[model samples]
Target: MTDQSAAPDATPRPLDHLAAMGAPDALALVDRAGALSFTGLDRAVGALARALDGRGLAKGARVASWLAKTRLASLLPLACARAELVHVPINPLLKRGQVAHILQDSGASLLIAGAGRSGTLEAGDRPADCALLIEDEAGAASLAAQDGLPASAADPDALAAILYTSGSTGRPKGVMLSHANLWLGAVSVAHYLRLTADDRTLAVLPFSFDYGQNQLLSSWAAGACVYPLDYLTARDVIRAVDKHEITTLAGVPPLWVQLAEADWPEATAGRLRRITNSGGRLPVPLVHRLRQLFPAADLYSMYGLTEAFRSTYLDPALIDTHPDSIGGAIPFAEVMLVRPDGGLAATGEPGELVHAGPLVAQGYWQDAERTALRFRPAPVFSKYGGMAVWSGDTAVMDADGLLRFVGRDDEMIKTSGNRVSPTEVEEAAVATGAAAEAVAIGVPDDRLGEAILLVVRGDPAGEGALRDGLKRDLPNFMQPREIRWRADLPRNANGKVDRAGLKAELTS
Candidate 1:
């Protein structure tokens, strides 16, 4: 990977970062609205920035967008970056209450949405200071046609976006990110993934999430064409890949599982050159199946948090030997496993994963307590002494300097004098080829203190066979006390398995 430590300081203007790459006629983005070249994208972003700036808002004011994945929504991020306004993207799946929480928390002065979405908000939901700007096709075209836009007015340290992530138990918290964070992240991921102008990326993830947003930034950094998609099913993704001849695709584990089970046309499967995954671990069984399904594509298993955008990504070359590992740090990141006492964790020891470097976010917006709990100072061994993100997720570093995700620090199952990772049990069940999806949770028990409860979604007739296999594969402590079969498991807006929702339902 290219050294990006000096990239943020060397290029303060994010718009200029894209300009220095290549010819202006290179393709940058593609959607139903058609393709946008680098020069066209720069001009459109500048025009929109001018329109937003002409609204007389103060510098660094917050601007929120709650719309579906569209060309306008895609360009708004770069527009806000050039205009020096903090962009807050709300997931289109969120309800009015959730949208209200984000607008209030971010102190957003302006809100943009489609007419249908804007009508969903109740009176008094938005802040009194906020103004509404409804985006219609005509309105967007007019805005993009404006000329004589002012130059970019942002510093590298200024807030670029506030991405609100769902908290375990409470309202979502907005993670603050700076221009340097977004710029360096785009450059770093593009460099490591080997993106080029010939590649075409299909973006299926929501722009509200950091991982989803990176799909656009990284592709643009390499002057590649990005197709923003709001797909409904695996078939939709398959059709898009076939139609566009897509070369690069990114997905979370749950989505990957759905795609692996679908019937793929041979041509579509071979069209994919690279596939990257995050949001959760790719189950070993799914990994093997994906390898067989997409023999020509390189599968990259990655791990990341919203606070740092991304931490580690396993090299595609090592997927055969280290199918379960999350690999080492990505570019411009210093990933160190730190124990609870603030010391380096020895090899094979489980500790909190801490990420330090330019990729670190600027902390949560307007939530000091939650920020303090997740973001902290760097350890004494670091080359630089700035703030670092203390990822609450637990992991272990092996002797080869590779990282393995154990489980969330808060979600570890403590039973019978032992700490067990739920992922370990869940992965073990899926590896037996009897279940499509599995979730393991600890429940109250009179004898074992806490017993393992396995929730699976697959054929009901196969439960007996799967249970028999689990008994032979797992120890007594790791075995599930009961196996519950369901038609399907719930998923959050970001498409992760809804473990939190399951626990809440059990209590209710």
Candidate 2:
């Protein structure tokens, strides 16, 4: 792995990642509107930045987008950075309530959505001060545009984006990211992955995800092309790879499984130079199958959290000998395993994973209590000392200093590449009056890393209503795989429902 070292005095903003890129006429982005060259990409970002600044919002205003993966949607991150605004991209799969919480929590001054999406918001869902614009009507049209702003530079540490992620409990919290964090992250990944201008990355993941956002950022940093696709099925992704001659692909374990199940032309599969997995572990058997299918492609197994952006990625060469290991720290990150008392863990001993470095996020937005809990002072042994993300995940470092994930210490359920909050799901169910008492737990599944199994003490006759309500209110990933009703739920000594007891019983 390349050791990342960024000098103290010089730091770049997010937009600087794309500045001075090679070959202005080379392809940079491809979407429904058609392909955009490096020149076109710069013009698009400049035009969008101009339009956003003309809205009369303050320089540090929060701008959110809830549109699907379109040309404009794909370019908003860069545009927002150029305008000195914090961009918040919401997952299109999120329901109206989820979108509302993000806007209100981030205090977004403007939101851009499609015309049909505006009516989806119910009363009180939108903040009073927030302005809405139909993206199609906003019309980012121009081939010759330049940044008219003065040569004044932006602060690298200024907040650039607020990415909302479902915590272990309560509502989803926003993770604050600075310009340097993003620019360095892009540099780190692009350097390690050896991306080049000839590579074409097929961006299939949602922009809200940190890993997904990098698909655009890293490619731009390497002066490569990114083809964003909003695929409805696994077949759509397979066809796109052949059609676009995609060379780089990133996915979670669940998505990798879905793509594996679909039939692929050998020639098309060979076109992929590298594929990556994060969010969840890939079973050893599946890893073998992927290697067999894509003989020419390298497979990267990674582990990350939103607070730190990324932690470790196992090199492709180690997949056969150490398929279970999460490898060592990525560039610009310091990964350490700490004991219960905050001391360093001995080799082969399990401890909490702590990440410290420039890649670490600023913290939770406007919520100091939660931020203080997760983002604490770095371990005494850390080389990059400051604030570090104390990830509540248990892991062990091998003698070679490689980390192998043991288990999660938190109760968050990871399903289909999405982190789900158990409490949030239960609260929504109770609000629908489907249950008086509820306990949400994650059950082991073959496909999804963890499938939600909701147990409630309510009328069995309300099953139909509960299902319908959840379908309407929750995202597809957050929906429970099965609903079971009981007369009583076990309680711990504190008098709260025992989610641990339910998970143990169900999984056993």
Candidate 3:
């Protein structure tokens, strides 16, 4: 890991750095608003910042965006940063109640949304104290003629954005990120991904997610172009790759499973240089299939949490040898496996993953109880003394220094007086080639205390065949007691399978 304590000078700020990358007319983003150049992006952000300031929002006040992935939506964060305001991006897929919760919870001073989306909000949805600005009305030409926002004493340590969690378990809590947290994360990812000016990345993930938001930052940091896409199917992704000659793409495991099954044209397949995975582990069988499909493209298996933008990434070169490992720490991050006794775990022993470094976020926005539980002091032996994210994820470090994921501490299933990782069971089910996706949950059972419930989405005809395969592959206690087939599993806004939701539904 690079020196996290070292601070980078921020006189021009990150937004200006993108525009000053030599070619002002070079493309920065492509969307319905047309091809926006670096200079155009800089000016557009400035115009919006001025508009927000003119509308009477105090410096550091929260400005939330609840629109789709439009050009204006892409510019909101930069605009908020320039105005020294805290940006809160709400997932467009959220319902009325969820949107209301965020608006009231953040106590935002203003909200910028599309005309169509703005009409969807009821009186109860947004606070009476907060103002609303229609994005379609905030055009570049009109806003540019107005006065620009006055400079402020904004520093790197100031809070930049508040990203809300998926809230599968409870009400969504905002994850606070500082300007330094975002800036350093962008620099680290761009350096390690080897992003160059020639690279054209497709941004399909929601910007509300830290992983998705980094797509824009990392691409712009490298002077590369990003194409914003709200794709509906695997075909759309393939078409975008061919249309924009996209070199880099990032996706969750569920999306990858769908894309892997799509029929890729030779030209579309050749344009892709790299694909990164997170949100969940990529099954070994799917990894082999991706290699066969995209022989020229590099595959990066990564592991991360919202608290820390990213933690580890397995290098493309080691994909075959270490498919199960989450790799070592990424740039600017130090990942340690701490045992239950609050000490470092020995080699091959599973321990909680603790992330310590600059990338650790500022913690939850207003939930101190939750924040204190996840974000705590660094380990006793650490070189740093500040707070570290105590990620509840369990992992084991091998002799080669690569970290392999076990499962979440709370998600571990107890069966027959033994602890079982749902990931292990799910991996085995997917390897049988009888299911496209699998999730194993433990429900109440008097005999076993908790029994395995294997849920899958695949051809119904193959269920018996998969059961036979599982019988041979798994021991008695680890075997799932029942198998249920569904047309499709429910996915949250982040594209991850809604495990908590599924469990609640089963119990209810």
Judging by lDDT against the true structure, name the best candidate: 2
Estimate the TM-score of every prediction. Answer: 0.80, 0.96, 0.79
What are the Cα lDDT values of the candidates?
Answer: 0.82, 0.86, 0.80
The residue-by-residue lDDT of candidate 2 on 45-80, one tens digit each, is: 777777778788899899999978888788888888
Q: Report the error of model 1 at residue 146, Å.
A: 2.0
Ranking by lDDT: 2, 1, 3
The digit string of per-residue lDDT tens for model 1 on 1-508 reads: 2233344233535543553353588777889889888787888787888888888888889999998899888988888877778899998876676688789989999999999988888998898999988889766755664773545656778888999875544556889999888888888788788787888999998898888999988888777888999998999999999998999999876578789989998889999999998876676888898999999999998888889878899999989889999999887889988898989999999988888988899998888998898889999977655898887888998898899998775665655423456876787689788899998887765344467888999988898788887775555667898889999999999998999789668646
Q: What is the lDDT of residue 111 in candidate 3?
A: 81
Ten-residue region with minimum lDDT total, candidate 1: 1-10
lDDT of 1 at 199: 88
Tens digit of per-residue lDDT, candidate 3, span 1-508: 1123544333324442444442577788899879888877777777777876676778789999988898878888787888888999987765555577889999998887777767877887889998887776544344453555533446878898999873323456899998888877887787778777888999988898888889998888778899999998999999999989999999876678788999999878988899998776777888998888888899988888889878999989999998888898888888999988999999999999999988899989888988899999989966655899998889999999899998776776755434466776787789899999999988876445478999999998999889987775555666898999999999999999999899889967
Which candidate model has the greater lDDT, 2 or 3?
2
Residue 446, candidate 1: C-alpha displacement in angstroms: 28
Candidate of highest TM-score: 2
Candidate 1, superposed: residue stretches over 4 Å from native:
1-12, 19-22, 148-153, 411-508
